[model samples]
Target: MSRSARAIAVNAALVLAAGLTLLPLAWMVSVSLMPTGEASRLPLRLLPSAPTLEHYRTLFTRLDVAGYAANSALLATAVTAISLVLNSMAGYAFAKLPFRGRDALFRTLLAALVIPAQVGMLPLFLMLKGMGLINTYAGVVIPGLASIFGIFLVRQYAQSIPDSLLDAARIDGAGELRIYRSFVLPACTPILTTLALFTFMGTWNDFLWPLIVLSDQDRFTLPVALANLLGEHAQDVELMMAGSVLTVAPMVVLFLALQRYYVAGVVSGSVKG
Candidate 1:
C-alpha cells in the first residue's frame, strides 16, 4: 500500500480502537444518568431518554459518599505528597550522591520489586498493627510513602541531571538540602508530576489495603465504600453506576490535566535512563 493510504488506514484503526475503549465508560455515564430501573431493562439501553442527577444526589446526600470521597482525597493526597519527597530524595541520592553501598542498596530494592507486593502485605499489616496504626489513615499512607518503582523512576530521571551543576552548587557552599531544593527538584518536576499522578491514582483506586486496615465504616475510602455500596445495592444498577462514576471521574480529570507532563516525564525518563 502507498504511504498515504497506510497512514489513513492506521488513523482509522486508532479511531476505532479509541471508540471501543471509551464505549464502556460512555455507557457507564449514560446508565448512571438513567432512571433507577432503566439500566436493568432489556436490550441494555446505551443512553438514557431523560438523564437525571437523582442517583448522584442520593449518593452524596443519603449514602455519605462525601465522607468516603473525603477520605480517599485526603489519603491519596497525603500518600502522593509524602512519596514524592521520599522517592525524589532517594532517587537523587542514588543518582548523584556517593554513599557507601548505595548501588548495592538500590539494586537490592530493584530486586525486591520482583517480589509480589501481596506477599509483604501480611507482614506489613502485622507491623502496622503493632504500631497501633490499624484502622487509621496513617496505616494506609505509610506503606505507600516509599515505593521501589517510584524510587527507580526518580533515580532514572535524576541521573539525567548534570553532575557539574550539582558540583557548582556545592562549590558555592550550597548544602545538600539547599541544592536538592533549588536544583534537583526543579530539574525533576516532570518526573515528579508523573509520580504524583501515579501515586494519587494508585492510592485513590486502592481497595484491598484500605479494606484490610480500616475496619471503621467512616474511614472507608471511595473504592472500599463503593464495594460496600455494591453489596447492599446489587440490584440498584443506576446507583452503582453513579458511584462508579464518582470513583473514576476525579482520576480521569487529574490525568487529563497532567497528560502533557505525564507523557513528557515518561518519554524523558525512558530516553535518559
Candidate 2:
C-alpha cells in the first residue's frame, strides 16, 4: 500500500513482536515476586496478590546463589576473553595470511560445524579426565576457547580490511605479531565485542558441560545451580523463578550494554560477505 501505511504497519508489527517476546520475561519476574504457593493457585494469575522478596532472600541467604553467580561470571568472562584472542588470531590469519592449504583447512573446519556438539562430548570428557582437569574451572573454560562460528565471524569481518593498509605496515618492517596487535586488533573491535558478548552469554547459560565437569557444590555455575535447585525444590516454583531471574539478569544487562557493537558487527559482516 501507501508508504506511510506500510511504515505504520511495520512499527505496529514490531511492537507486537516485542510484547510477545517480553511476555514470558514479565511472567517470570511476576512469578518470582509471588508469595509461595500463590503461583500454583487456580486461574493462573500473572500478577501476584502481594509481591514479596522472600524467594529472593531465600535464594541468596540459604541457597548461596551469589557463589553460583560468581562462578558463572568468572567462567564466562574467562571463556569470553580467551575465545576472543584465539578466534580473532585464527580468523585474521585465515583472512589475510596466505598459506599452503589454508582455504582447504578453513573449509574443513567449517564443515565440522555441521556436526552436533554433543557427539564430541564423550571423547572430550575422557580427554579432560585424562588431563586431570575435571572439577576445575579450566575444564569448563578449555572447551569454549575456540569456536568455528567465532572464527568465521572474525574471518568475514577481517576480510573487509584493505590489503593495501596491511602491505604498508609490512613494508615499514613491522613484524607479523606487531601488525596484528597494533592494526588488525583495533580494526576488528566491533566484531570482537560481538564475539565477546556471544561467548559470555553462551558460557553463562551452559549447563550440561559445566555440570559434567564440576562436581563440587561451591564450584557450580548459576545454570547448574538452578538445575540443582529444581531437583531439590521442584515444588517451590517461586524460588526457582527467582533463581532463573538471577541467572538471566546478567545476560540481559550485558546484551543491552553491547547491543550497538553486536548489531554493527552483524551488519558489517553481512555487507562485507
Candidate 3:
C-alpha cells in the first residue's frame, strides 16, 4: 500500500474505533430519555421516540438516587482530602529526607502493590467488622485514605524539587512538617491536584469494595446503590440511564477540569524516568 493510502486507512480505523467506543454512552443517553417502557422494543430506537425527564425525576424524588449521589460525592471528597495530606508527606519524605533504609522500605511497599489489594480484602472486611467500621462512611473512606500510586505520583513530582529549597527552609527554623506544608506541598500543587483528581475519581467510581462493605442502603455509593436499583427497577431503562449519568458525569467533569495536571504528571513522569 502507498503511504497516503495507509494513512487514510489508519485514520478511518481510528474513527471507527472511536464510534464503537462511544456507542454505549450514546445508547445510555438515548435510553435514559425514553419514556417509561420503550427502550427494549422490537426495532432498536437510536433516540427516544418521545424523550422525557420523568426517569430523572423518579431517580431524584421517588427512588432516592440523590442520596446515593451525595454519598458518592462526600466519600470521594473526604478520601481526596485525606489522601493528599498523607501521600504528599510520605512522598516528599521519601524523595528528599535522609533516612536509613528508605529505599528498601519504599521498595517493600511497592512490592506490596503487586499483591492485589483484593487478596487482603476478606481479612480487611473482617478487620473492619471487628472495628465496627463496616456499614459506615468510615468503611468507605478508610481503604482509599492512602494509596501506593498516590505516594508514587507525589514522590515523582517531589523528586524534581531542589534540595536548596528544603535546606533554605531548615536554615529558617522550619520543621519537617513546616517545610512540607509551606515549601514542598506548595511546590507540589500541580501533582497534588493531579493526585486529588485521581483519588476522587477512583473513590467515586469504586464498586466492588464498597459493595462488599456497605450493606446498609443508606451508606451505599452511587454505583452500589445503582446496582441494587437495577435489581428492583430493571424495567426502568430511562431511570437506569439517569443513574448512569449521575454516576459518570462528575468523574468526567473532574477529569476535564484537571486534565492539564493529569497530562502533566504523565509527561513529567515519562521524562523523569
Candidate 4:
C-alpha cells in the first residue's frame, strides 16, 4: 500500500476501535436514562424510548447515593493526598539521599511487591482491629498511604532529575526539606500528577477493603454501597445502571481532566527511569 493509503487505513482502524470501546459506556448511560422497564425489554433497547432522570433522582433522593458518594470522595481525596507526600519523600530519598541500607531496603520492598496484596490483608486487618481502627475511614486510608508501586514510580522519576540541581540547592544553604519543597516537587510534577490520578482512581474504585472494614451502612463508600444496592434491587435494572453511572462518572471526569499530564508522566518516567 502507498504511504498515504496506509495512514488513512490506520486512522480508520483507530476510529473504529475507539467507537467499539465507547459503545458500552454509551449504552450504560442510555440504560440509566431509560424508563424503569425499558432496559430489560425483549429487544434490549440500545436507546431509551423515553429518557428520564427518574432513576438518578431515585438514587440521590431515596437511596442516599449522595452520602455514599461523599464518603467515596472524602476517602479517595485523603488517600491520594497523604500517599503522594509519603511516596514522594520515600522515592526522593531512595533516588538521591545517601542513607544506610537504602538500596537493600528498596530491594526488599520490590521483592515484597511480588507477594500478593491479599496475603497481607488478613494480618493488616488484625493489626488494625487491635488498634481499634476497624469500621473507620482510617482503616481504609491507612493501608493505601504508602504503596510499593507508588514509591517505585516516584523513585524512578526522581532519579531522572539532574543531581547538580539538588547539589546546587544544598550549596546555597537550602535544607533537605526546603530543596524537596522548592525543587524536587516542582521537577517531579508530571510524575506526581500521574501518581495522583492513579491513587485517586484506585481508591475510588476500591470495594473489597472498604467492604471488609466498614460494617456500618453510613460509612460505606460508593462501590460498597453500590454492591449493597445491587443485592436489594437486582430487578431494578435502570436504577442499577444509574448507580453504576454515578460511581463511574467522577473517575471519568478526573481522567479526562488530567489526561495530558498523565500521559506525559508515564512516558517520561518510563524512558528516563
TM-score for each predicted model, relative to the true structure: 0.93, 0.90, 0.93, 0.92
Model 4 agreement with the true structure over 1-273: per-residue lDDT tens digits: 999999999999999999999998998899999999988789768999988999999988999999999999999999999999999999999999978999999999988887887888999999999999999999999989998888998898888889899999999999999999999999989889899998999999998899999999999999999999999999998899999999999989988998897787667556733
Q: Which 10-residue window of candidate 1 scores lowest in summed lDDT?
A: 264-273
Per-residue lDDT for 126 in model 2?
Answer: 96
Candidate 4 wrong stretches, greater than 4 Å: 1-12, 264-273
Give stretches of model 1 more than 4 Å off: 1-8, 264-273
What are the lDDT scores of the predictions, listed in order? 0.92, 0.92, 0.87, 0.92
Stretches off by above 4 angstroms in model 2 are 1-16, 42-44, 263-273
Q: Lowest summed-lDDT stretch of 10 residues in model 3?
A: 264-273
Model 3: per-residue lDDT, tens digit, 183-264?
Answer: 8888999899988877888899889999998988988999999899999988777788889988888887888888998787
- lDDT (Cα, tens digit) per residue for candidate 1, span 128-165: 99999999999999889898888998898888999999
- Candidate 2 lDDT, 188-231, residue by residue in tens: 98889888888889999998999899999999999999988899
After the best TM-score superposition of candidate 1, give how far the Cα of residue 52 lies from its true spot, in angstroms.
0.4
> Number of clashing pairs, model 1?
0
Candidate 4, residue 54: how far the Cα is off, in Å: 0.6
Q: 39, model 2: CA deviation in Å? A: 1.6
Cα misplacement distance, residue 29 of candidate 3 (Å): 0.7
Q: Choose 2 or 4, whichever is better by TM-score.
A: 4
